[model samples]
Target chain A: MFRGIVFAFLGGACITLQGVANSRISHDIGTWQAATVTQLTGFIMALMIYLFVRDGDLGGFRKVKPLYLAGGAFGSVIIFSEVTAIQTIGVTFTISALLIAQLLVTFLIDRFGWFGTTKSKMGAPQFIGLAMMIGGVLIMKL
Target chain B: MLIGLLLAAFAGMMVALQTIFNNRTDVHMGSWATTTWVLFMGFVASLACSLIFEGSRTFNLQQMQPWYWFSGLIGVGVVICLVLGIKILGPTFSVSVTLTAQLGFALLFDSLGWLGLEKVAFDWKQLAGVVVIVAGIYVFKFGGKKKSAEAVQSASAAN
Candidate 1:
């Protein structure tokens, strides 16, 4: 848990900013169009960095599964669904549902060691801690 | 409303799965390359959807700020850090911490009204929520591990 805490926090902050930015962009053009622009710009930026770094073994590509290579497609649906949900159910409910679902999926993934992740054993303390976190999220909405 | 909630939840699931899957790709492709590949895939998907559903509306860039168009660059930072964190801490713990950090930013954003997001009045309830979440993480990290942690450390040392 402690490992890569900085990276984790930074990732979260960046997501928030990106969400706000996406919303603003969508307002200007259109939702899916905004998504297209986002992905395009993101790809370009990442490609630039990759070329500059000149790292990672090309041979290791064989080690990665084909299905995982398409992971980025999820972003399109994520953008589309989340925006529609917010419009239909409102921001508060959308945010709450999003957080809960995310936590639930991640928790299940950890407990089952799904998709090749390390299995995490949960005891009473872990459960209690998780409950508290959920409570905190709900409270934030309230 | 139920459908809306379901859609929201499904989006959440995608968010989680996307990170995990992207991390797996990162293991082989390296950080920047993995990010590039993921974004490229996303671009293809979004473009397809745009053409099919969004169609004519998709191309109308009618005099919007060019700066806002660059927002996607921020995704570069988000993906790289998330993959790095997941590599070290595993998905669940890493994501939980990420959520906490996000809320912290939310608080800051709300207080300052940054990026034109509505300025939410600072309230004790929101403050308490932050406190509780932090406490939860503290418990998850170090609670009930005093003697057992020491014992494990010693056991490992002896091995």
Candidate 2:
């Protein structure tokens, strides 16, 4: 559990770092080009690791669903939409709305077993926990 | 405008969905391999989109600083961390923790005026918010365990 929280925190820090780095790159190249470059660099890095580790079978990808394979495509949309949404709706509004939307969808997925996730029913306390978290986010933005 | 709003909402859902997909894929492939697959697919998709929409536009890669190129390395870290983190913490908790940390770092960046970001004043409210988020995590941890255990049992039975 502690390890999980630490990983989560590290993931968040990486996000900020990546956003700052990507913005700089975008300023030089256009957004799409920057995205392309970033994706290429990431691909290379991951490829290097994969080659070194050589753990998983590349051929196994055929067994995975096409929808699962579309994560990368969704990632592109995420980048594009986040950039535009922040521009249109202001950062605070955009972040708040996005987080809320994310939480709601995650909850539904867990609760209803949608999108290949296990169904985890939420109790009142879980709902309160969620509300409190969202409230905290709103407060932080204030 | 409505379309934009819907897109924004969809975009948020996509983030969650992407995480779920990546996590599932990670279960089959190792984390590094999964990262490679995702990046490769994303690169191809974006490259195709760029070619189609933007035509052939060239940017002088030589003029850019070396540090800018490292963003993808950081991105690789984000993907790996998220895949592993979500597997352990579950999506909701993982997202909450990630957001809290992101907000904390964002506030730090704003106040310190690091990385060319404009300085923003920090007030007590922001501090309070951070505190509240921490409390919320505790609340969630305490509140959700029983339900989650039941879920696991039911899921196994269904399978």
After the best TM-score superposition of candidate 2, give how far the Cα of residue B48 lies from its true spot, in angstroms: 2.6
Q: Per-residue lDDT for A11-119 in model 2, tens only? A: 8877766554554566566667667778888889889978998878666777788788777666666666655554454333344455556656766777788766766
Error of 2 at A36 (Å): 1.2
What docking class should model 2 receive? medium
> After superposing candidate 1, which stretches have Cα over 4 Å from the reference?
A1-9, A57-62, A84-97, B1-8, B80-97, B111-113, B141-159
Interface RMSD of structure candidate 2 (Å) = 4.7
TM-score of chain B of 2: 0.65
lDDT of 2 at A134: 76
Model 2, B46-87: lDDT tens digits are: 777767767777344665677767778888677667666777
- Candidate 2 stretches with Cα past 4 Å from truth are A1-8, A85-97, A140-142, B1-10, B58-63, B79-97, B145-159
lDDT of each: 0.68, 0.65
DockQ for model 2 equals 0.52
iRMS of each prediction in angstroms? 6.0, 4.7
Q: List the residue pairs that clash in candidate 2.
A: none
TM-score, predicted candidate 1 vs. hidden true structure: 0.78
Q: Can you give the DockQ of every candidate in the order shown?
A: 0.52, 0.52
